[model samples]
Target chain A: MAESSRADNRVLLLKLGVIACVMFAFAWALIPLYRVICEVTGINQLVKADAPAPAVAASDLAVTAAPVRLRFDATVQAGLPWQVRPLVGQMAAPRGEFVRVDYEITNASNREVTGQAVPRYLPAAAGNYVKKLECFCFRQQVFKPGETRRFPVVFVIDRAMPADIGEITLAYSVFDVPGQGAS
Target chain B: MAISTTAGHAPHEHGKPTGLWRWLAATNHKDIGSMYLWFSFTMFLSGGVMALCIRAELFQPGLQFFQPELFNQLTTLHGLVMVFGAIMPAFTGLANWLLPLMIGAPDMAFARMNNWSFWLLPPAALLLLISFFVPGGAAAAGWTLYAPLATQMGMGMDLTIFAIHILGVSSIMGSINIIVTILNLRAPGMTMMKMPMFAWASLITAYLIIAVMPVLAGVVTMVLTDRHFGTHFFNAAGGGDPVMYQHIFWFFGHPEVYIMALPAFGIVSHIIPTFSRKPLFGYTSMVYATSSIAVLSFMVWAHHMFTTGMPATAQLFFMYATMLIAVPTGVKVFNWIGTMWQGAMSFETPMLFAVGFVCLFTVGGLSGVTLSVAAVDIQLQDTYYVVAHFHYVLVAGALFSLFAAIYYWFPKMTGKMYSEPLGKFHFWWSMIWFNVTFFPMHFLGLAGMPRRIPDYALQFTDFNRIASIGAFCFGLGQLIFLYNMLRSIRHGQAAPHKPWEGAETLEWQIPTPAPYHSFVEAPHVEAGDNGVIHSMTGGAHH
Candidate 1:
């Protein structure tokens, strides 16, 4: 009986050891799985590289579309010596139609600079519907000393967007990437 | 295995080893348990000091005492020390001292491993405390250690991670030792369901520790690699989502909440029945309820991240699952009240803390239900309401139960009776001050004061002052406990083998000042046996 109890303890120890390992792997598995879940469901507004939102068939347009006012805003983060502003402060677009906006950027410092633009949407609830097809935010933009460039963002306001949100403001803040500086 | 003749004796049975060296090299569960308790008390004092500092700063709201950065460190360390250092270890200490006695086992299954597990804690604790004096101060990103902030932190964050890693290793080792001991070493006839509730609680908690401690280790290792090895596990530019980090974290983090509470539930299960002079009401249902709570804990992690903007369906699912937890928890609460129904109830210090635990913890549970609603949480997230809610659960639930267990077991442990008046005084003082300190924070949260901020607007002044004063009184009240315990060990009345008349556990059946090698004979118990040694000795030993 003593020997049997010792063996029983050995088995339980091994069992606990295996459970610990499997749970560790389970925690790791949730990482990639969460990204997939977020993208497929559009929960957390996990932006996809090509298009963030599900494709809304062109046929689903509103029969009599109301015009929505779109506004653009841009600014440079504290340490990045760059000047960036929206080319046009506001524009009008009908629901279910695509809109294009530009932001002007200039390197205000003596050295060349590389900056990444991070996008933000007001009412933050509107983030998932403001799908970007092409935006400067998807890639880093580089500027030479005394250089100026115009960056464009192409987006479509889903007809499915809540009617309460008649006005949408898209803002971008530019920051210098440390290791990618001047490249 | 026949019951041995040596089962019910005092320390006079053998020559006792003496000196600090005996403690330094000891493998006895009783010695190690004493060490764990003392160490946890020291940590409790340290963490309590930090809490007072926080209340002092927030007294009038404009960072009266500390710089904002220092307040951040104080808040972070307070949470870390109290949760990890004080509460978790205190229960582990209880398990060590009582499990072998309660289950009629000779000692833990792996004695040397128990020693190693406990020895690992001091160094880890030193690493955490030492980080404060390091160049940039200890981790200021809060105890959650969310990435991006963690990656950007200075050297102190690295120390905190290392400390956490070491602490995780210690807990996992302790957990394995516990699992092996309980599953393999219960005395004959003490079947799985027949084991005491404290043992059952430890069994479940140990399994939980093994399952989640590694997840913590994994996440912290990633954060370390992300900081030093350029790994992009949480870096957005490098194609990693920080939200994924929160997902993995809360998976482990949510269970950790139960890891601290379940053992307290087990402790209270024992206390309520004893003081009320009745068998625990609905024992089978209580076990099932604890198991169900453990299972549901895994599904409710996302309720914490509701404001992170999960899909409405996912939010709804988590909200419902979180509310489902209230059923099992409500069952346990009712079981406690039922245990006291129509019985000769006594208001001993331990019983007072036990009853207080039920009342305050139920309040916390109700607030938990309120916060579980995705809409309500959207407003309450990261607010003082969240702060108030957890302290109700943790301080009132876990800490109160811990005090109950201490008062219940004090005579058995030290072989002397504590001053009953002092114990009651300590209980009332703590209860009043505890409520005063935390209750108004709910209003403060509803009025829009965010947590983890050192400075607040002028509107939050009056209640903050009241809370600060209550906190100081609460801190002072604990000194009464410390003095009472110290005096009891040296000068109090001698305790009998069974101090409380209604107590019927295996621990009470043994002699007072439970010897080093408890239950070396493995006393044989039977089904429906109240106490084998109690009946055998005919209650004359005491």
Candidate 2:
């Protein structure tokens, strides 16, 4: 009886050990699982990469309705030794019609520097409605010593945007990317 | 039989080692249980000191004694110490001492491994304590160690991570030991269904620990690698979402709540019935309630993350799932009251605590249900309401149950009875002051007072002062418990075997102070024989 009990103990221990190992692996498994869920559900919008906009027919554009006022803003993060300013302060563009805005960047530092631009939308909900066709924020940019460059941002505000939001501000802040060169 | 060979070297037969070696190389369950209890009590005091420091700073509005950073460290350490150091180990100690004796087993299935499991704790605790002196101070990011904040902490965070790893390993080993002993070492006729409620609770709790402690280890490892090894598991710049960390942590954490409570449920189940002089009401339902709670615990992890911007559908699903827990929990509560109904009941110190646990834990449970609403949680999250909610469940629920167990088993453990008046005094003192300290936090939380801050606005002054004063008194009350326990161990009245008339279990069937070896020959139990009923009605022993 004792011998059988001892054998039973060994089998139970092995089973429990396997459970612990499997749970540990499950924790690691959650990472990819979480990403897949977020993408499939279109939740966790901040983490999801911006998808390329599908082709829009002319009839889909709301060209005759009232235009929404758009405000452009740009700033360089501290210690980056870079300056950025919107070439156009603001514009009014009809809903569903694409609008283009320009911003100029200058590197004041002596060495070539790599930086990434992150964009923020005012009233954060606007992020879901404003679709970007092309933007400098999509990738890291490299500026040579004393270099100046111009970048264009093209976007269309969906007609489904709430009417209460008459104006939207699109802001960009550039942060230095350490330990990386232009790829 | 292998049992006789192992029993030949029983400490009682060969005369056991004395002094430090007795504890250091101890394989006996009772001695290891005693060590675990003492270690947890020390940790309880350490965590209590941190709590008092926090209350002191929050006594008024401004930062008087501690910097915000230091205050953050105190709150963080207090939480980690209480949950991991004080509460979890206390339950493990209770299991170590009680499970084998209750189930008529010779000793734990893996006794040597039990020693290693316990000894690992001191080093891990030492690591946590010393982290405070490190260059950046301890991990200032709260006990949750939510990332971005956690990733920015200094060397102390790494120490905390390593300590948690060691602690996790200890818990897993201890849990494995428990599962094996309960499953494999029952005597000839003590079937799983016939075992005491405490044994069933411990069995389920061990499985819960086995399932979740590894996940905790895994998440903390990711944090360590993120800080030093260029991994971006939580770094948004590297395509890792911080919310994902919340998801994984709560997956382990929600069940962790029951890991603390289930053992308390077991302890209270014994105390209430023993005092009431009645068989436990709805014994079968009690087991089902415990098992259901464990299973549902895994599904409600997302409730803690309602404010983390989960979609409304996910939020609603988690909210409803969280609320669904209250049903089985309510069933257990109902059954406890049902046991005490229309019985010849006594108000022993243990019973007082058991009753207190029932009442206050209900309040905590109700508040938990209130917080389960995703919309309401948006307001209550990070408030003193959350703090108040858990303290009720933990302090009133788990800690109260621990006190009751100590009192209920005092004579059995020490071979002497504690001073009754002093025991009652300790109970009332802790009971009143505990409410004074935590109950007002509910109001403060409702008034929009955020938690974990060094200072509050002027309007939040009066209640904070009351809570602080109550906290100091609450801290003082524990000393009485300490004194009673120590004095009783040495000078209290000598107890006979079966000190409590209504007490009925295999442990009570043994000698006082319980011998170093018991049940060398497995005791045979018969079908349809509840241990309590048979023993009380003059049934055969062995």
Candidate 3:
């Protein structure tokens, strides 16, 4: 019985040894298989994500041949507590070139109260080019019993825009401009 | 092993379960075991029907047949049915049948809890199924039930949450029973090490369910409060961060993954050596690895949320923790193949599935590492890649292990052998069609197709069509398996003692039609060279 038991132990040990070797091979094989799978599955697809380009920007063609000629789509509201960002929607540019924003603001308040409306461009980077558009930050508006106001400014750009870049963005804020008492 | 009954319970013979009352009032382990199995099989088919509905819907795009609301409902129901209905119940069923037999015990320590545990599921599933007809339709928020979205859903979501709570309670009760039984009910000769791999696995998995099922319960509870009771636990407007919800969910969720997988680990451990006709290799190492994987499971919860924009330090910690799981998991795979190496081998259907499990589970594991990388996961987090990875783990790993287990033990249960040729055909069909259905999903996901979308860009139309076809074939093939199991049980040729030609387990060595009671005289213990009972023999089983 002892001899038979000793032989069984030997067999068990040998089996264990062989088993270890097989495991090593399986693990090794998995490394490359994993690599191939990762590559196939686009494991690196979102590493450096690029934001999508906009569909079509009218500002894209605000070229060096013209001033920053921007057309604003305006809606006038009577007694609705708001007015358009650009009334005449007049934007000055060097004919066909890209520069900065130019626009007119109208306050439709009945009382001698002061407030300001912020402007935003369709493409984001248009705000990056400055000095052409007069901002609400410049001065306080006081409508002395129905004030019809027009604000304007002038500036240009360094003329550096990507050819495929067909969009520019401008964003602004609207608030009761400082030093003008509306409350 | 070396445990006293933490709770007071008598070892009672308990009368034989007879008539309908027996089933209703049944606390005996055997009756409960049979009930769990039958219930799971019923659920398996029911879930299978939902899968077919999903396949039929996706058979053609452009809303050919089913409307989008119905399509979303089908998908939601499919997820709930498969997760709660089919897979979890299947594992619990195996636990019921095998726990007593493997442990050399008369029955589970708390048999009443086992019965109560199973009874909860039918009612809960009924509620979930019944939600379909109740006014606003089923929960289409998907299984994760991401908040604000889930909060805003209709009555179906409410029913689904209630159903989830019931399922959670059942799982916890069932787990507590297994833990108590494994600890207290082993025969006198058995030690902890003498326990089968399955017992150790179920022990760990039981602990997982007990710990995390409560967390899932807590999570859904919070969801309910957020939705109806004006709680701001997940509302960002009320000083609550939405991302915190993901943290809690995955905390429960990651361990829930292990709760499913560790049993598969145990099943694979059991089947690998049987077919190889060899003693299990690295038995102690296997134990340690299982424990390690369980421990690692808690820390890796955040790996799922890598794309949710956590701090760099937090992301790094989670990423590394997740990767370390691969080491222990790797050890398990090594141990399995190691058990089979240079041994005499035969290709029974059980063995075939076991071998397939090794290869395919590795495919699942290797993909797991890709998701573990903080940088790489940014792209893959909620895509079809995540979907495919889990199915590979759950389906190929757990479900295939389930198949191998069914094939392995059908004889012991039925007293007859299933046709081997037919079994092999089912295996190959499942294997081929499973790959076809899940593999293309990776490419589609990589090609930027997001998951949970009802419609997709025209570019993805072809792969979806092919996948739909694969899904149908796969669902249809399961019929072959069900038919084979039933036919074999009723009228197939008789199975002898130890039907697997070279299987060495005590379960196989027992008589065909394994009697209502087994080894009732005295325990027969087998000792290895190290004077350890490799597995305890259940002599006092009756």
Worst 10 residues of 3 chain B by lDDT: B1-10
| Candidate 2 per-residue lDDT over residues B334-363, each given as its tens digit | 999999999789999999999999999999
The per-candidate TM-score of the B chain, in the order shown, comes to 0.95, 0.97, 0.94
Model 1, residue A124: what's the lDDT?
Answer: 73
**What's the C-alpha lDDT at position B433 in model 2?**
95
User: In model 2, which regions exceed 4 Å deviation?
Assistant: A37-120, A124-138, A141-183, B1-13, B527-542
- Over the true interface residues, superposed, what is the Cα RMSD of model 1? 5.5
Off by over 4 Å in 1: A37-183, B1-17, B527-542
**Ten residues in a row with the worst lDDT in model 1 chain B?**
B533-542
Backbone clash count, each prediction separately: 0, 0, 23
* A1-183 per-residue lDDT for model 1 (tens digits): 655666777678788889888877877787877768767877665443444545555564453267778888886654578998988899998876778888888898888788888887887767867888989889888888888988778888877776678788888867677677646
Classify candidate 2 by CAPRI docking class: acceptable
True contacts kept of each: 0.48, 0.67, 0.00
User: Considering lDDT, where higher is better, how would the candidates rank from best to worst?
Assistant: 2, 1, 3
Rank list by TM-score: 2, 1, 3
* TM-scores for every predicted model: 0.84, 0.87, 0.74
lDDT of 2 by residue, A44-108 (tens): 56555456555555654444356888999877654578898999999898888889999899999
